[model samples]
Target: MIGAGMGAMAAAARLAVAGRRVTVYERTETHGGALRRHERDGFGFDTGPGLLHLPAVWRDLFVKTGREPLEERVAMAQVEPAVRHVFADGSSVALPGGSRAGTVEALDAALGPGAGERWSELLVRAREVWDATRRPLLEEPLTGAVDRAALGRDPYPARRRGLLRRRPATLTGVARAELRDPRLVALLESHALAHGLDPRRAPASAVVLAYLEHTFGTWYVRGGMRALADAVYERCLERGVEFRFGTAVSRVVVEGGRAVGVELADGTREAADAVVWGAGGPVPAAGDAGEAGGGTGAAAGRLTVLLALRGRRPEGTAHRTVVHTAGPGGTTRTVTVLRPGDPALVPDGEHESAVLSVAVPPHRAGAGRPADRAEAMDWTAGEWAAVDWTAPGAAERCADEALAVADAAGLGLGGRLLWREVRTPADTERETGAPGGAVPAPVLAGADGAFLRAANRTATAGLYRVGGWAHPGGGTAHAGMSGAMAAGLIVEGDDWRGSR
Candidate 1:
């Protein structure tokens, strides 16, 4: 394994249990890739994902790898009123978790009569899309030649309106045609944006993203999401998987048209029969062999602000809140505020820790230059200077914008905040080695398969891909599934379809 990310570690554990000696070489001194935690004083915050959806992925991992189940490894519970949405129009609604009827009732009560029914009807269609693609997209590993022609077609059953037989093809189109209300549209679009997707370009099948959360329910593990990462790392150790941290793999050693080992950054070569490329960016020796043919489209990264507050967390507070604001050019922007009531996160009962996050364009050298100047610059300029996140307080400014939105939604953190830490895409890049900190979005079927990640089985024989950068794409659940699929392909042969 090339990295000790959640997906890589998951694969390492399983492969070890299958009687294969597994070794992971991580560039950083940590195990989790993006699943990192930040601490100050006695306060800790999850800088990566704040919540876990579709935990069955991890449950299956534990069940298969050991006698102990996932629940025994970590403390987790469903977040009630899964999310509270505060729209720009000053209307708010708290949707109950895992209960379709409850969600409908809450929407009707808050957004007026019939609104809940409309939302429920859309979810019904989302279920259809999920059922159609769940197997091919999530459970099975993508073949060398993916059936793009079939999978490229949107599975979302958009209802036809008027005399014309036209149906919405994109997520934004569905929001306008079916959702109707602006607030409802914002609600739907927020899900896409949160996953680094643009609703205008995302396929209608992306509705399944919301469906998965609603059906599986949102959950938070005690001591932040990093605890889940720690559990997986511990599992790998228990399975006899070896991990070498602070070590980078410079290239995969290829011979006779097959990947036989990896060359370390220190000029040391480690031989192996098979290699799993789970790190971000690019596979060293694959030569674009595993890249998605049509590309996965433009991806965005996250800007997170960790706030330490002096006041006690109010009782009955929703675990998550999404504050929607109108962006430039009529676009909608959202900042998600997370205030888990876990005691392990705060210094004491009198203090609280919260996380605020928003999606932004991935970092690029000179990408932040003034638009007019950028248009005038030479196309082949040499080594443009790196984006100065600190100059003029760029990260702080972005965090302020997000905090303002959250405050306007009634969070009122300004008066209680003790200190704040801003994390930008540059920080993410430094930590995970993902270029520009571009977080990969989950693979969706549509737009001629433009959003799909590369297949697990690469053109280089004996070299496989796992993690968010590969098929099935990002999200904790998807990453775990990627590991299982890669393990199955290696142990059971390429003929293995998936779990039956």
Candidate 2:
């Protein structure tokens, strides 16, 4: 394996369970890419997958491996306020990711009279789209030559039943055709862009995002997500998977278009029959400046964050904040805040929920280019030793933006003291080797770029990739499923299940 992030680990776990000797080569010490556990000043937080959704996916992993999952160690509680949206009027609404009836009711109260009925109708429409797109587009890989004729014939059934049309060609058109409320449309489409693709112009299949959230539901893990990672790491050991820390991969060594092994930065190479690109570093962009010597376009916007909370969380009464600050330079700043406790996310806890966050549209560093996956995480133990976790002013401008979001949510922090930390997108990519500082395939764009994400599969043979950086994008579940899917392809050679 070239990277031991979530995808790699899940893949390794699969191969190892099948009585295979799998040596994972990770450039950094950590295993889970975006799903890493950071501990500073006795406080531990899961910097990735802060919110859990699409549960059946993980349940499927445990069933596939016959090995218990880390889920046993952690409990999941549906986020009561699945998401709290506050506008400039100081008016706020909590959008719980469940129940058409309740959500419809909430919509009626928040939007207008018939909005509740509209919500139900939209849910029905979303379900129709999900039933058609889930398998063909999301389950199967979209790679090889773009044979428009052959690709369009896929079973994802982009063609709806008379009344509607399912098309992967355009995003905005689909939205215009289906949703009437601009706010509702924004809510439906925002889920797609979470992964990095601009949803407005993406594709119709991306609508699966809204469908999945509403259909499957969303939740927060009790006692933090770190416990889950540690548990998985421990379980992998029970299955006899060996892990080495503090080592970095120099390159994925390929011979004659075949991946034979990985080269470590320290100049060591390990041989293996198959290699998976779990840690596919930044998918290079078009015109990033900092990327000249950094390798690719994806390297320009690398960013990661670590928000260490000081004093107390918003007193019992919760407040959620998601802020979008359009910088003068055009770069956008985003700060997400989750209040401490809700039976769904955090349990009756001793510590307040470490407000989770991320900033999109990072400042472009330089210009060099490639148009591939955006970024990946490279974790090193030594690097973790050097950071100043106590400083909150690291991204002063971003911090101020976060505060503004709190005020917008009608939250008042009585100014107490404890801890504060910030990591720019550059900081995250540098710390974790997440190329472009991209959030692990957290949001898989639909609409237009869905086909392009199939790049998760490498150009070389015997090399497979899993993790947030892969095609389907990020999610502990997506990473885990992707890893297993690739391992299945390798184990069965031509007979593997789930292989496209």
Candidate 3:
């Protein structure tokens, strides 16, 4: 295995349990690819994902690979009022976790009469999309030739509106036609935006994104999301998986049209029966199998601002809040504020740690030329090549913009902030080695299969792909599922379908 990311580690543990020796070579000195934690003055923050949804993916990993279940390995709880939305009109709504009836009631009470019914009706359609694609997209590994035309057809049931009877094809269209209200439209679009997707281009099937969270509920680990990564790493060790940190694999060693091993950056080669490439970025020795590319455009990264405040966290504060504001060119931008109730994240009850995040163009280190020298460069040509996040005050300026939005949403942290740390896509690139720190969005079915990812089984016989950039797509839960699918394909043969 290459890279000790959450997905890689999950695969390593499962492969080891199946009587296969596993070794992970990670470029970084530490484990956990993006699931990083920053600490200062006893205050810690999760720099990666702040919450977990569809945790059953991780639960199954623990149940299959070891005697201990996921709950026994980590302390976690369902976040009540899973998410709070503060819209541009100063109206707000808090949706309860895992309760459809409660969510409908809360939306009605907060957004006024009949508003909840419109949103609920949309979710009912979302459920159909989820049921149709859940097996092919999440559970099974993409093998052989994929039926792009079939999968590309949007499964989201369209709403019939006037005498013309037109069908909405994009997420934004669905929000406008079905949701109707601007605030409800923002609510629907926020889910896609949070994943670095532009709702304008995203498929109507993207409605499943909201459906998953509402049905599965949101959860937080006690010691930040890093704790979940640590648990997975520990599990790998217990299963006899060897990890070699600070060891970078330059490329996969191909022998007789098959991957036989990997060559390290220092010219050392390690042989293996099969290789799992979990590291993001380009796949090495992919050959012809790598040609199938669909979801590689408009990939954006996240900018997170960790705020340490001097005041106590107000009781009953929602765990997560999203504030929507208008952006340049009539676009809507979302700034999400995460305030987990876990005490381990802060110094004490009197102090609180919060994370404010917004999606932005990924960092671009301007090729070989200095960033300052590339001032006249075109922004649209190279993905993330135009934004110089390392430029002085760039990250701070973005953080300030996000903070202003939070303030308008009544976060009330102006006088209580102690210190803040700004994490940009540049930092994400240095940490994860992904070009431009571009985080991969989850795969959705539509737009002629433009949102699909490369298959886990590559043309190189012994080589396989696993992680956010591969098959099942991105997200903490999807990455875990990616690992399981890869491991199953290796142990049970290519004919193996999926978990029975």
Candidate 4:
């Protein structure tokens, strides 16, 4: 394995159990690619993903590798009232999880009558899309022989209203056609935006994202998300997977057009029968040189602010709250407030630790090196770079913005803030080696196939890509799926359909 990201470790555990002497080389000193934690005093914060949706992916990993189930390894709790959506129209809805009827009721209560019905109707459509693409687009690996055309075909059906036959291909289009209300439109588009995708271009199939969250529900590890990664790492060790930390893979050693081993930065060479490339390691800093190259259209970056408050969390608070704003140009600006359900995250019973994440565009050409100089003057470009959270003093500005958004949603911190820490995409790049700290978006079904991800099987024999950057694309669950698909291909051969 090239890197010790979740996908790499998941695959390592499976391959080791298959009687292969699995060896994982991680560039970082610690395990868990983006699933990192930050601690100060007694407070803890999950820097990467706060919640795990569709945890069945990891559950399947544990079941296949050992007798112990996932629950045995990590304690997880379903987040009640899955999310609180605060829209620009001053209307808010607290949507319940796992129950379609419950969600409909909440929407009806908050957004007025018939609102719930319309939202529920949209979810029904989403379910169809999910059923159509789940097997081929997600469970199976994307190989040369696979029918990529089928994956590109949109499964969402067109809408019919009187004489109008509206066939909206994108999520934004669906929002405009079916959900005429701006708040409801924002609610729908927020799902796509949260994934670092532009809803205007994202396929209508993107509706499945909201469906999956509401259906499977959101879950959080007891201690932190890092605990989930630790569980996977422990599972790998139990299967006898060897791991080398603080080691950089200079290159994948190729002989006869096949990867036979890897060359480390220290001039050490380790041979292997097959190579799994998990690009979770850190990339080069600023002008520093590195083996990894930069790529365009990497998923948008996240700006996170960790708040250490002096007050305790009030009772009946939503686990997650989304504050939505619109820019002068009408683009949505979202800031997600995460109040971990676990009490262990705070320093004491009298205090609370909250995390705020805002999706920002990737610094594709780095600061000042514009991809299009004229585009910078455009509203989108300015809106994208409005918060360079990595810049000095920008953290304070973003924290203020988050607190303001929270306050507007009636989540007032008042003077309880003790301290704050900010993390930017640059910080992520340094940690995970993803250029500009870009977060990879999940692949979507679209007409031009512009959103398709790279195939797991590369041109080089014995070499494969696995992780958020590969087939099925980003998100904790998707990464786990990529690992499973890659491992399946190696263990079951190229003709492998998928894991049963």
Which 10 consecutive residues of model 2 have the lowest summed lDDT? 373-382
lDDT of 2 by residue, 378-418 (tens): 11111111222123333444444555455555555314324
Clashing pairs in 1: none
Each prediction's Cα RMSD? 3.8, 7.6, 3.1, 4.0
Q: Model 1, 451-490: lDDT tens per residue?
A: 8888888878898888888888998889999999999999
Q: Please give the TM-score that candidate 1 achieves against the real structure.
A: 0.95
Off by over 4 Å in 4: 161-166, 280-298, 364-366, 369-390
Better of 2 and 3 by TM-score: 3
Candidate 4 accuracy as TM-score: 0.92
Clashes of 3: 0
> Which digits, one per residue and each the tens of the lDDT, describe model 3 over residues 29-140?
9998899999999899999999998999999999999867899999889998899999888989988988878888998898888888998989999999999999989999
lDDT of 2 at 1: 64
lDDT score, candidate 3, position 494: 82
lDDT of each: 0.84, 0.54, 0.84, 0.79
Better of 1 and 2 by TM-score: 1
Instruction: Report model 2's TM-score to 2 decimal places.
Output: 0.78
